[model samples]
Target: MKLLIVGATGTLGRQIARHALDKGYNVRCLVRNARKASFLKEWGAELVIGNLCKPETLLPALEGMEAIIDAASARATDAIKQVDWEGKVNLIQAAQKTGVNRYIFFSILNAEKHTDVPLMEIKHCTELFLAESGLNYTILRPSGFMQGLISQYAVPILDNQAVWITGASSAIAYMDTQDMAKFAIRALEVPETKNQTYPVVGTKAWTAEEIIQLCEKLSDKTAKISRIPLGLLRFLRGFTHFFQWTYNISERLAFAEVLASGKALTAPMEQVYEIFGLDSKETTTLESYLKEYFSRILKKLKELDYEKSKSKKKKKTPFKSSV
Candidate 1:
């Protein structure tokens, strides 16, 4: 089947495109910048320049597409209403007009439960809109991404930098993007998955403190930690909306306020795995993923140090051999 991946330049979107191609599906990417997304082209995906905010450009991207994996999401610095709200409405309309099938939408886990949060409210609204659109749709509500934690927690700990965390009681079941990608492509083959909503999460839920402790053990370095209160984030969310330029700050602050609300973002996955016909053992665990990442990074750092030492030694040995 031919598939189109929206937001193909993003981390999860790229993973979805790769998994789709690996499964022998014709993959096309609806991208905003062809130059930035050139790697997708090299990986055998057809690229079409389009922006979700611009409704006029969506038809061309949606043309002749059999399936759509909408991984497109507003960034922290983006206009949430424009991209996540208005832009999504436009995409749904275009998909309907073009008669697209097998629409897969990625949403946040437990988004409906926290509609008071700005980002969660937007996601919940979009979920309702898509389900009511009369299209064959599957909604995937994924937990925090393991790949994201690498930069947010692991890297900072490795570098001995201050890691900012909030809501020590907050726990999240973070899944690997690659695993989530597998679920998306596999959904196409399962007719029962149509019009279904599944919460895709990891096997275990972990707290912020537990994650930091694990990072410290793996890196063998103590992390400099900075704690931010959820109340402060809530204040910033309202305060930053006063200016146009700072609106981006307000947009992302909503997420911080919600994620740090001492809530657990988790769901039962046995049914999800059974429906998708996947074995639980095949999923990537947080421990294994982090171990591999740290191993690779530490090896590279050692190689760099060895190369620098050799360079200095060569200079010191000098021209005596030539004379």
Candidate 2:
């Protein structure tokens, strides 16, 4: 099957492209920078230089493709409207014009319920557009990426920095990007997954306190936990309107409260596995993912320490008595 992967340079999109190639599908990628995407050619992907923000570029990329997987996301608030909303609409139109058979999209879990949030609102609008575009579609609503949590909470603990947990008792599930990519491929291949939506969740759920424990056990590093009340999270989210921020700190804090309330957690979906015939892959645990990442962090720290020690010795040598 010939497949075109939009946003092929992104974290999840690249993985999907690689997995599709590994599965022996002919892969094409819509890319903005041919140089950055040169490596993808080595991985057996045909790179079509184009930006999703420009509709004229999408037609050439969408041509002669059986399916399109949209994993694109905006980096900033303004880009969200242009890229996520407008860009996806452009792709849907191009796909319809080209008679593309299937359209797969990765949207965040609970996006339909969070229309007030800017990012979610964009995704919600895009989902509506895709459904009405007269193309066969499969939508995967994945939980937060496991990497996001590990980078934020696990890395800080490994580096001996304080990580603040808003609700100690809140439990949330996170999926590895690799797993999400694998499932996305299945959705493309499996007949049962067509024209359906699935909540692609992690194998297990962890509470905020349990998250710290897992990291502490795996890295052998103590994590300083600062617990904040839920009320404070609401107060903090109110501050997002004062000025623009990149990390979406306000939405993050607000979502933290949702995780704490257990509202965002995905319940077990036996039907998803049964219908898709998804085999049990290796479990993705925080301890397992952080082990190697912590080693790298420790290695970098040691390198910096060594450099500082060498500089100190050079200084202590007294400059050869100013000779």
What's the TM-score of each model vs. the native?
0.95, 0.84
Q: By TM-score, who's the top model here?
A: 1
lDDT of 1 by residue, 1-323 (tens): 98989988898999999999888999989998899999999999999988999999999998899999999998766788899889999999999999998899999998998887778899999999999999999999997999999989999998888899984556899999999999999888999999999999998988888888888887888999899877788788889988889877776777777678787889999999999999999999898888888889889989999999999887765457763
In angstroms, how far off is 100's CA in candidate 2? Answer: 0.9
RMSD of each: 2.2, 3.9
Where is the poorest 10-residue window by lDDT in model 2? 246-255
Model 2: per-residue Cα lDDT over 154-246, one tens digit each: 778876888887764546677778888988888887888888888888877777777788778767789998878877777777876566763
Q: Which stretches of candidate 2 lie over 4 Å from their true place?
A: 76-78, 227-229, 242-262, 281-283, 291-323
Off by over 4 Å in 1: 167-169, 317-323
lDDT of all the models against the reference? 0.90, 0.80
Model 2: residue 49 alpha-carbon error in angstroms: 1.7
